[model samples]
Target chain A: MKTLFDKIWEKHVVESITNGPDVLYIDRQLIHEVTSPQAFAGLRKRGISVFRPQQVTATPDHNTPTLNQHLPIKEEASRKAVEALRENCAANNIMLFDLNTEYNGVVHIVGPELGLTQPGMTIVCGDSHTATHGAFGSIAFGIGTSEVEMALATQCLLQSKPKQMRITIDGNLGKGVTAKDVILYIIAQLTANGGTGYFVEYAGSAFRSMTMEERMTMCNMSIEMGARGGLIAPDETTFAYVKNRKFAPQGEEWSKKLLEWKLLFTDSNASFDKEYSFKAEDVKPFITYGTNPGMGIAIDGNIPVNEPNVKALEYMNFAAGEKLLGKPVDYVFIGSCTNGRIEDFRAAASIIKGRKKAENIFAYIVPGSKSVEKQAREEGLIEIFESAGFVFRQPGCSACLAMNEDKVPAGKYCVSTSNRNFEGRQGVGARTLLASPLTAAAAAVTGKITDPRELI
Target chain B: MQKLTILTSPCVPLNVESVDTDQIIPARFLKTTNREGFGKNLFRDWRYDSEDQPKSDFVLNSAKYSGQILVAGKNFGCGSSREHAAWAIADYGFRAVISPLFADIFKGNALNNGVLPIQVSENFVQTLFAEIEKNPKTEVTIDLPAQKITINSINLSEYFDINDYKKTCFINGYDDIDYLLSIKEKIEHYEVQKS
Candidate 1:
């Protein structure tokens, strides 16, 4: 009768207070530059050290400069944060993926790429997108800095267990609809607050058919709908993806681990607190038209007629019932923790192989990690991008939150493949339209909001 | 964390729905390791113009309304797990935020800090906004032990819920990690058993 989330959570729960949060042990802890400095300072103030330093992994991502990675970072605050991460990791003897290292990338992407994110593990990070690791059937979510310190000290956290939600998407996905579009469609249909108190498990055929990278992208944005995290049951697809990675178990140990992971699925008799089913056909090449991620519509669909829609239209400089067929866009960013994988680039490149980017659009193609960048270049994807007139930037969380120099200008429209479309997220007064890489590629070549299906 | 037993202040009403953390504290301001100095940057884009001048039309800049409690619309603090959002709110002199709903991470962050996030019924939230709109000086008191929020003008009272452990922390002005450390023996024992 227990759901997969419950089974995982129950296994991790060390001690449960009668009516309070359960103290759940963490297996893998991920750290990054932005939210970890205060935590380390707190440990120092208390004259304490990290409990299990080997369990922790740190990287410099949020504030790292995307361009000229080897050069001295220019911004004082950005440079300080990156420096602080290096100093802290070195002082503590913790594993750090320095900017020069091949392992360095967004913390979320680097975790799975290195095989550090195993199925049935409890992972925590200070970044909300930690849910991306939940794609491996792990109970993973974001934590505050204090919780970061607690996890650093105890390798555990006190968390109130969330209710279970099973969102089943069946049927076949239409052409040009990527995992990014599927998630955007779900968030929009569910609204921003729909999954407020649930740990969602994506089930059914559509999710099962997705590649590991696609599943990661789908789970990455679960937090946008207010879900604590999201997960998919482990299967052959999951096992096959985890094989032969850097930190994954080798040979005999792999078979033993796979045997255990095989039982990670939800039993047919298991029940969830809530369940929602959707037809994959209902999803299209989606794009957000407002300040929030939930304010999304299909690429060829009309904006909904509502007071909130009117307000969103006002903010986005769009009109109610207006079709966003050829809405002018100033920028197109194809990277973030959300869609900065090699598969994302392949999807975008497949659409823009021979077409030059629209003369008016400033487009960027950034890989999620150094290895992803290397793999893309090795496969000639960078040449495809350059030939299509797109600037291929170094890997980091560039233009996602505009913490670096890749900010979208004020009052400009950017069709981004990032998770969020919040007001001023890319820059002050910068309007973001969330979409898939294919849709972004189409918009980049057309200089306006165009559906990838039309070009496909 | 400071003791938050009781607080009475004129309500600052922000009626906009789904106010995300990015709008609460922009990412550019998140560079500092210290939680200090975020107050000035709270709602940085909304509160300031391109020239860094205070926007006269922004709610925080209005002199008529001043309070430590902000009565916001539904789904407040809806995106990002940046505790900087809570830091900015607390530093901006807000002692509490009352809304119909709050993002789970934001609620956790608020409670960990000294800020009390009160989840009231939608009707009560609407009433608070209406009362605040009708009279800018509408004062509301949150009694933590009693778990009641009273509107002075309307003579109305509503109760809210908070976890007992969190409530204990709020009333005693205790650090959260210290509480977890109090049960360190039990945690270690369990870890040993599992291994």
Candidate 2:
């Protein structure tokens, strides 16, 4: 009996070097502005071309401004970086989803929504959150620029197979608890370094019940807990989600692909190198109080007095044993690869409908992709947000890493729905508290950290 | 890649935990296509003030600490798989980083970029910090061929671990792309068989 990870991994292992890393074949490659420029330049320097250009897709997300997609990128450096990507893609004959294109959004979001990320495939992107695509039962992981170039040149990566870990969460989640909370709680329990050198497969009833989008959010933060990547076994939820997307198989090809995907589950009695089980009941709507995602506690829970992460505490301006409930917040961000999907917007709209944003809160509701933005508008989540005094912005990796104009000023507290609360992540000296979109919505309405269950 | 084997140098100690990539090189500096100038902004937030002046208290700014090696706290390079973090460290003239734990992607990036990421025991890390605290001039020697690191002043030595292939690459100054391109025929063969 082979585990799901082993099955996919073995298929992708092209040639294994004795006592060395395996040359793993990649079925799909996703590239973005931040990491691909250097890689493309390396190719140009070598007088080489991409080995399999058709399998690769390129977009500019990290530095793209969320507002004014029709206008030229204002920052010269960012403009050059993006222009370099476009130039490289054109030269390499790779597909380009330029900014303002219907398919353009966050690279990770755009991949799955377009059905380019399929089960049993090996996907690698330069960006770490490439794990977000693991929701579809693929062996997807992030790579550095060097590996990016290697993949671009050979359509393979020289990688050592990581140990396998299965994190099982059972039982139904209570109100206000989201996939983001479950992941945050799991990371808190495991610590950021606990999953180092391992690829995790999330199993059991709770993960089985999460929607494809929710599962995307769950696997998206695997890097935060130090896992190389994370995935879940594909089921009907997976098949239904992949049915009619732009890139998904059509007609007779669909049945053949479905048969292959249906077999993408872990066999009975297949053992993982490590295993941990958590109850969904224990996972509450959580928020991080420190610099790392692993330093999270449930809303209404007290910060640990004995926790010795003094630097994190000082950076967040938080004290031991202090409750985060009702703590003042200056901004609320509800977007990123983690929570920038349509359901996230719907969830935020559920709590924010007819409620004006707090006077002290500058709430920004940005979609993850152009498709998600269109869907939100179709569902009138934008109207709900705009009416509630929350600014609705276009899609990009905005405020999450704050590469663009959407920044939280220094010494300001923002309840963000994106991953990572590291200092200067939102902006230089900006304090970030990571939470779910619902929790971010609650903070936007109350202008403080409040339990979303109260509104639910 | 520069050939690295036996190297001796004093180390810079960053006594901070969970030092994410954002801290190593903030996102604002990541827009540039060129990777050479990142050293100037390495740890930009911590090394400089809002007015763009160097912070006197930061380790890099202090004359007491100057080294090609950076000894950092646990879970170094935790967030964002941006190779720019490895670029900034290498650009700042740090040839090696010693830590108790390293985020996986960062370790890979560091190794690929010719920045030696040496993972040692927690106790060993603590001892090194203590030794450095007592004497800023403490010298650490990384003997890559022997898979060992020695603290010359304290006479304490420990055998570190590196993948045999990576050790070979370091000594020979080879990169993944070179190996991959050499096996271009094999890759093409595998693709044909799979299809």
| Candidate that scores best on DockQ | 2
What are the per-residue Cα lDDT tens digits for candidate 2 across A320-423? 99999999999999999999999999999999998989999987788999999999999999999999887789889999999988899999999999998999
Give the residue spans of candidate 1 off by over 4 A.
A307-309
| lDDT by residue for model 1 (B1-195), tens | 889999989988898888999999999999998878899999998899999999998899999889899989889998888888999999999999999999988998898889999999999989988888898999998999999999988789999998787888899998768867777787778778876
Q: What is candidate 1's TM-score against the reference?
A: 0.98
**TM-score of B-chain for each predicted structure, in order:** 0.97, 0.98
The alpha-carbon deviation from the true structure for residue A97 of candidate 2, after best TM-score superposition, in angstroms, is: 1.0
Q: Residues B1-195, candidate 2: write the lDDT tens digits.
A: 888999899999998877999999999999988767899999999999999999999999989888899999999998899999999999999999999899999999999988999998888889999999999989999999998998899888898888888899999999999999999999999998987
lDDT of 2 at A325: 97
Tell the DockQ for candidate 2. Answer: 0.88
Query: What range of 10 consecutive residues in model 2 chain A has the weakest lDDT sum?
Result: A386-395
i-RMSD of all predictions? 1.1, 0.7
Tens-place lDDT per residue, model 1, A1-456, is 778888888998877876678888899999998888989998999998998899999989888888899998999999999999999999998999999678999999999999999999999999999999999999989988878988988787878888889999999998888899999999998999999888999999999999999999999999999998999998888888889999999999999999989889898999998999999998888999888888898999998766355666777898777888898899999999999999999988998898999999998778899999999999999999999888788889989999999999988999999999888999888899999999999999999999899888
Clashing pairs in 2: none
